[model samples]
Target: MPGRPHLIPGLSAVPPARRLGSSWSRGVVASAAACLVLAGCSSTITIDDHDLSDADRAACEALVADLPGTLAGKDRVGVEPADALGAAWGGRASYVLTCGVPEPEDYEPTAECSVIEGVGWYVPDDQLTDPAEDATPVALSRTPFVEVLVPAEHRTEGIDRALAELAPVLEEHLGEGLSCL
Candidate 1:
């Protein structure tokens, strides 16, 4: 999880203890936005100059492994690959959008680790507070999935630029009629 959109700096999923402290803040944010599940997944993206320590790296690896079950099936739209699926733990991405189909009625519930950038400070394009009006994102699987961004002095900075660069080339391959997530 290097280049694409990640929860780089400002992006952090709250721990259970922390959640109790920000109950009001979380409610306000939850009601305002919709969730975006990355439809198709490519390799792990690398964007910034992250110097995670060994312990931190281990933590991140564990987090990614825990993500697949969270995105079971929110096939917004797209196709799956011809090669057979990989082992659940063998995959780089937690979930993949292999089943190309119409969007699901309800997205798979956002999990603790699935809240945002599994990386560090990445924010979902769909969740931008006041994003560009003509935000034609590089569709992940018909809908915008994740973007690994370059890090800026601030966690939220550099994201827009990453989106600009990423949205153009990350076209997904639509197969069958369901989702791989």
Candidate 2:
């Protein structure tokens, strides 16, 4: 009785505590919101199959097979209409990689590029600064041209990590002559 608050006929003697301006509570709410968003998305992602020559298809298949089971802290997930030329990771905000794709229309020799782990990537100018939510970077100076669709939510750093992780596999399967210089 001493430690407990007295209860009236229809209410407790003490009012419920408020968690206003609580950072911890705010963080919990944000995390739960993110989880809900992700949960609402289908685990299977759609990746269109590319038309490629036999040799290019072979290389893409090999590359897809060699891709890491995880990238950028996200586990690899199944892709719908499954094909060897494409693979994807994460849910909702997914990282999609497609091989045997044609070069970007805007791609030019003078375009800005980023070299990660000795692999060259053609990053758009906007992507370098403030990228839209669905900017993609394509591999440069590599055969069977590859590209990765990185959601803006992942930011530049996350895309960099994904490119770094895939560089070795790309080099091994696609062969390396990547030059941004």
Top-lDDT candidate index = 2
- Please, what are the lDDT tens digits per residue for candidate 1 over residues 52-164? 45543443333333333322221112212222111121133222221111233333324122222222112232333332211111122322233221111212333233323
TM-score, cand. 1 = 0.22
- Write candidate 2's Cα lDDT for 1-181 as tens digits: 6676444332213211210001001111122134325746566666666778988889999999889989989898887667647787787535778888777776776765555665677755544444434456678767788878766566544766787788889988995534554
Query: lDDT per prediction?
Result: 0.25, 0.63
Can you give the TM-score per candidate against the true fold? Answer: 0.22, 0.71
- Residue 67 of model 2 has an lDDT of 92
- Model 2: CA > 4 A from native: 1-41, 176-179
Q: Write down the RMSD of candidate 2 (Cα, Å).
A: 17.9
Q: Which run of 10 residues does model 1 get worst, by summed lDDT?
A: 24-33
